[model samples]
Target chain A: MELEFVDIRVERDYFLIQGAGIFAPGIHLVSGRVGSGKTTLAMIAAGLKTPDSGRVKRHGIGSVMLSMQFPEQHLTGSTLESEIASWHLQPCPVLALAGLPGREKDDPFSLSRGELKRLHLACILSRRFDLLILDEPFSALDCREKMATADRIGSIRAGITLIFTHENQHLPRVDYLWEIRESALEFLGSVPDALVGWKNKPSVLADLHKRGVYPKNLSTADILEAACRTHD
Target chain B: MQDARLRLLTVIILSVASFMSVAGALAAFIWWIIFTPGIRTIAKSPFALFFLGFTASVSAVIWLTGGDGISYLVRMAVILLLAFYAYTDRAPGDFLDLSVWLFGKKIGFDIGLAAEMSLQGMEVLSDEARRTRVAFRLKAIKFGFRSIAPSAGLMIYSQFARAEEQADLLAVRGYRGGGMVCPQFTRVKGDVIASTSAILPLIFAIMPVGDIFILLQ
Candidate 1:
């Protein structure tokens, strides 16, 4: 179960991606500045939109899921409980995981944006898919929630998962890293190695790297621990 | 009729004829089902069930008042037919073209633009609502009125937000409303005949057919 984008070129009026190719499994963290075609790449990779040239091929895929930036955009149930139920899973575990245990009977939209993001994450993560694409999964989330979401991403057993986000901080340990710069998708190889060349690396990581601290992990705690050790 | 102008005229004439007499209304309804889209298409519309219940209630009221319930039901059915026909037959930008052709440059274009936007908005709203429902289904939620209310609200809110953005986009493009578009129409072979047939129902209603039947009774 894998997704392959070979020499794909997607041209939009505002942005364009030319001659980009990616073939990978496991979690791939896609990062780029705003309007860098990250979401467009995710959509093309998820088979939501056709590339202008080249092709996208998925092999032996069972199910595919794409989570939009706005959690509310993916909401289809009237009540919180029904929304969880719609995922075809029990509401108890999902709600608890989402940190919205008692909001099952409440209107889904009545919750704040952060709450909705948590709920969407809980719902999408709970389901099993061959390929999962999350667009800006960290938006409207608190630091703690971001950490929790990163942990969840780390635990996913999906055949292939791609997270498209501009947020560099609090990203989980991903198998691979890719970025869109100047309308071209550049695969920067696996983690650690890829970290060396991330042009828009988060300030914390950049500071650590500048201080000669190549932390094994990017989580807040790990970076802090690495910084302290370097200081000592 | 394929032509929007001719179709609108037929809808008006038939609707007016429907209100005039029981015979005229029944003829219009029958004629619409036979010559236009037909009952199967109208029956499948989302609004069909609501109109069905409405017609039933109106028929019941007529019967309770010692009047012919069937006549009222027939008239209601004619209106529903018109609605179904308009919805099914309309194309994007056709209304704008028709309005411009009918009303000329200034006011006509504005009204047409408004109508076009409203129609497009409805289409977008419905498409988004369906996608949202599918999103629920993917999660395994059972779809029904109980589950649709809040989703409907979100869809509406999203549409409003999008409408504001669209307005901003138009403003940025220097749109101040008055414009010209080349009107296009696809004329079908039977458009003239069908439009001519619209007058027959009204004429049939104006005749003393109902009176003749009453005298015989």
Candidate 2:
């Protein structure tokens, strides 16, 4: 199932987001300031949040899975085992994938932040969801877990997927970069391509661009490597 | 940064709502607002909520069971134990900390006591620290452990002395028992949800026909 945000707009006590749309399949990055409504937009897109005046058009019949920024937030299971076992597909492996190395009987709260996130994702992937929404999926992950999760998610297939994050570098290759700036949604092109002459490109990237060696995609890795190349 | 406590307060608000059972999809909708910080910060109220839930559940069960003498004695014993447990010597801040752990971190401050203590602790600490700094300068101290520790100790001593003096002062004055003033707490969007959650059980309890079908274990 494809998820569509049809002119989605919202106005709450402090948040006022308007006219935003996110089309999915392949990873999508949502970046915004603290209150720019990046989360609000992601929530609305994933059907977890309702917009003041828009509809989440679930294009096909599908289930919705939301990976909360804090994996513990989504933990409804009493124990790790039950939660892992709660998945539709064989839930065991996903629990392992989440770095919860033992069986599912552990307390979900005992796992570290990254482990919890991975566990949440494993649950999402093990099930068949048309769309999976992950909020700040890499917040507390160590370097290894970060890359491992990126690789794992990079390997998955779903109808539409939305990931909210600020770390532009760690994200897998994606179809679009949706930025919530001042509560407005701006859809840049594909991740690698969308970042072309991107305004939000880091200072190092700007420096690289000045040196006439602009990357295909000016992500963290691309920019850092370009900086090193220029230095060398 | 202090104003940003609102966001943290948001979590407690939502958890309280969850505690009151405004859950399923609506709870899921606001889940991230609570979850992101809560996973990282942990809530202050989860345990308290759990205890409250257990108490409420037990009360409900007792009400249903029609209060036999043995069961009534058992229930009274349990209540006495719980009351005793609440009054035992807790660490200075453990009650708030427990509230935080119980509720989940983000929403931990939902227990008004924890939030109030947090703010008061900061204020008192700040006053003490400022007084210490002034004393340190009077002693012509530089930034080193030797100079700093003595000054800090003196400052803390003075703060305690002042606290005792204030207690005496309060006794001399026409002060009643209770506490001091706190910042006015305005309910954010989440508090409204909690209020609604409180009312929800009443609504559910009233729907005898459908609720009985679901409640029939």
Candidate 3:
């Protein structure tokens, strides 16, 4: 499956987001500074928003799912059981995966923001979609939860996944790298090659790059491997 | 309009005048064009389309029942226009200043605080509703008869949560009843002129139609 943005342009009050790119069936990491239209691009890609100009054409994509930045916005069910059931998943397995097993009677809103985000991510990652757009997936997550979420995202080997984040640490293994610079989305080619052109890269990646150690992917494990490599 | 007291008084006079008769509506419309920002502001508002659809439906019903649908439409439209003008022209602490100025600090301060919070709540409610709509769309759920209950429940629950947070914040800030605020207002020459001229429409509205024609003649 492939998703294409044909000269898409969205005009907000302050800035204009214009870009054209193709997203193939793999994990794509799109990064930008805060208030840099990351959420806008995600919404446009997920078919939840229409751009002022151009068109988004989805090829061979039947179902689409967007995990918004705020997990509270996705709360439709009062209780945990009903919330899990809202996603058409069994409560026991999903709750266990979210590390909240047997708390089905508890209210979803009563959960801490981190716990709610974990539950929301668990619900989303459990199912497969042709086009999955996650906006700021690692937000409100602790360091451990962030690492676990990255691993889970990296294991999804099917369809197209677009992760929009400005998160400097704990990222999934990505196939392509893109960023929004000066209100326009710029495609920076595939992973390892794209790392050199990334402007807002994480400090660790930049330090490694300065030392001539370019990681093969953005995952923490890949970075660790590159960090431990010796020049023979 | 910079003076909250004058603006509020103008809004009240224009609203009541517009509701009294079609001539009053016409006068209010004229006042709106001259004093308020413009029609484009109201047109661009999110509620503009909803208001248009509602007015059209009500007008159609009135016409079918042999009532003066045109007059009803004109008057209501003008009144709504005045209401929108008042809403858009208001600054954040306008009501607090006006209330405290009129009713003194004790009772007036409490009312103003309530009004401010309610207005803020409305804004938050609108934002939450938009996000909820997007969330429902993401889940492949059609927002219709079946989804209204859940949607409303979510919005109401969020509002309560937000209200509780605000209360906690206020308590932490050591907020007690009736705070002191030296109400300040800027009454420009235009404000005085507009306030003086706003009385004419009310007089025209309250007088007989024949008298207005004779006076005009």
Q: How much lDDT does each candidate structure score?
A: 0.81, 0.55, 0.89
Could you tell which candidate, 1 or 2, scores higher by DockQ? 1
lDDT for position B95 in model 2: 44
> Model 1 chain B: which ten-residue window has the lowest total lDDT?
B133-142
Q: What is the lDDT of residue B53 in candidate 1?
A: 87
Q: What is the interface RMSD of candidate 2, in Å?
A: 24.3
- DockQ, prediction 3: 0.54
Writing each residue's lDDT as its tens digit, candidate 2 over A1-232 gives 4567788779967767885464766677666666566666766765556888977787674666666565544433456775554453455677666656665667665566666777777676565556777777777887776766666666666566677777655655456777766677788778666666266655555666678765644334555566667443
Worst 10 residues of 3 chain B by lDDT: B40-49
Best by DockQ: 3
Kindly report the docking quality category of candidate 3: medium
Residue B159, candidate 1: alpha-carbon lDDT: 78
- Please give, for residues A180-230, the per-residue lDDT of candidate 3 as tens digits: 999999999999899999998999999998998889998999999999998
Models ranked on lDDT: 3, 1, 2
Alpha-carbon runs more than 4 Å astray in model 3:
B33-77, B104-107, B180-197
Q: Order of all candidates by DockQ, from best down to worst? A: 3, 1, 2
A88-167, model 1: which lDDT tens digit per residue?
Answer: 77898999989888777997757889999999899889887888899999999999999889888877765788989988
